[model samples]
Target: MQWYLCALTALLLATGCKKTTCECPPKTDDPKMEYTELNDKAVGFNSSYSLDLNKDGEADFSFSTLLVGDPVLRRDYRQYYIVSKFYTNCLVNGNEETPVLQKGDKIGSLPPEGFHWYNASHVVIAQKIIEENGTSWSGNWKQVAHAYQPVSILKGDKTYYGWIELSFDMQSEKIILHRAAVAKDPNVEVKAGG
Candidate 1:
């Protein structure tokens, strides 16, 4: 009975996606590509966007917002971050923050000198910290708009690549997720937004 239920669930999920084949840039269409249409979804305080790169039930990564207050310090801190999940990594370096990438960038192995795959859990996109002295802003996504970031998923010894298109604004403290795509083929470099 358990085996029958598992097969049924898998069949439903396989047909749940409305679109499968990707018709991206000319000659870049990949039938094995999986795309998720978020359509400018805004994730802010108390809200988060869970991304399942391979249509699996588990979350590969997620974008979230957190706000904490310290009465003793008389300040509040609001932060935005992308949390890397199990076997998932973000493109980062010694700086610890993922760099804002341009669209169509190649995400492959042995990335540039200062760039490599790292499991950057709780990667700050932006942070608004208010102290008694004053309010200060920090992080690479403070003023970013329509930026691309690389995400890698490790399965066994193979790695799959993907990208997410998003925007973050300090004024609204919101992270807008436009879309995400993943290449089903392992070790294949996937172009951002393609």
Candidate 2:
């Protein structure tokens, strides 16, 4: 009886010392398993901006647009593409600042690149907003955006329009991307694209 008790105690100790086995499976970095949603209640604002004129302090006029297109999923198994256009208007604030306006140029195939940082100024951080799909299915959204700069300013009035494109797998669920672009000249009257 004493020998049997010793053996049982050793067996229990050995069992306890063994490594724990995962019940479900090792955690995977699966994009499909991850669902990200954009927070509709979130507010977006720009902090770093420049005044166009030497005197006026307030932003007379400013606006920006973020265009998200449907995913063009084809050929490439599970890949997706997102194309966005960032447009903004900067109006002269000073009384004497009568400005001439010019239409933005459309450079056929590709837009300009390399001179500026893609996404640096805007803040689109979210605490993770969730949405439900009926009883069993659900989907998520993420706010992905880009800050654009005016291509050319002829007179006093300047309008900026830029393009930003992003591609990712389902793993890019709800990834928040913010952008901000500082004018090259600090003193020049500057306004961020909306």
Best prediction by TM-score: 1
**Candidate 1 lDDT, tens digit per residue, 56-145?**
789999998888898988999888889997699987767777878788777778675686777747787788998978899888888889
| lDDT (10s digit) by residue, model 2, range 38-127 | 222122222112222211344322222232233452111111112111322222222211122122222111232322312212321122
Off by over 4 Å in 2: 21-38, 41-115, 118-194
Error of 1 at 60 (Å): 0.7
> What TM-score goes with each of the models?
0.77, 0.21
Q: How well does model 1 score by local distance difference test?
A: 0.83
Give the whole-model CA lDDT for all candidates, comma-separated: 0.83, 0.27
Question: What number of clashing residue pairs does each candidate have, in the order they appear?
Answer: 0, 14
